[model samples]
Target: MEKLEEQIAHLTRTVEDLSDVVARQDQEIALLTRRVALLLEREASREAEGTGGVVLGDERPPHY
Candidate 1:
C-alpha cells in the first residue's frame, strides 16, 4: 500500500540521519582521545626531567 511505502521511506531517512550524526561523533571522540594521550606524554616527560618549573604563591619570583 502507498501508506506503508511512505512509512518505510520516513523510517529510512531517519535512520540515515542518525547514522551520520553517530559517524561525526566518532571522529570527534577519536581526535579528543589523541589529544589527551599527547598531553599525558608531555607531562610525564616534564616530570621525569625533574625541573622545578612549578612555583608556589609564597615563593618570590626568580627575577628578584
Candidate 2:
C-alpha cells in the first residue's frame, strides 16, 4: 500500500511538471502569434505604400 502511494505521488508530480511546461508553451505561442501578426501588418502596410507611391525593390531607375 505504501509503494502504491509513492507511485501515485510521483505520478502527481510528473503531471504537475508537465502542466507547467504546457502552460509556458501556451504563453510563448500566444506571444509569438501576436508578434507575427504585428510583423504581417507592418509588411502589408509597406507593400501598400510601395504600390501606392515608390517601389523600393530596385525594379527600375527614376529616369526610365
Candidate 3:
C-alpha cells in the first residue's frame, strides 16, 4: 500500500509538470500564430499597393 501511494504521488507530480509545459507551449504557439497572421496581412496590403517587391530605402525606379 505504501509503494502504491508513492507511485501515485510520483505520477501526479509528473502529470502536473507535463501540464505546465503543455500550457506554456500552447501560449507560445498562440503568439506565433498571431504574428504570422499580422505578417500575412501586411504582405497582402503591400501586394495590393503594387509595391510588394520594393526593397526598403531604395530610390524609385527609372520608370518613375
lDDT of 1 by residue, 1-64 (tens): 9999999999999999999999999999999999999998988889999862889999998899
- Among all windows of 10 consecutive residues in model 1, the one with the lowest summed lDDT is 45-54
For candidate 1, report its TM-score: 0.75
In candidate 2, the residue pairs with backbone N, CA or C atoms under 3 Å apart (3 or more residues apart, or in different chains) clash, namely none
Question: lDDT per prediction?
Answer: 0.94, 0.91, 0.94
- Give the number of the best model, judged by lDDT: 1
Best by TM-score: 3
* lDDT at residue 44 of model 2 (Cα atoms): 91
lDDT of 1: 0.94
lDDT of 2 at 35: 100
Give each model a TM-score: 0.75, 0.78, 0.80
Clashes of each: 0, 0, 0
Tens-digit per-residue lDDT, 9-53, candidate 2: 999999999999999999999999999999989889988788535
List ranges where model 3 is wrong by over 4 Å: 54-64
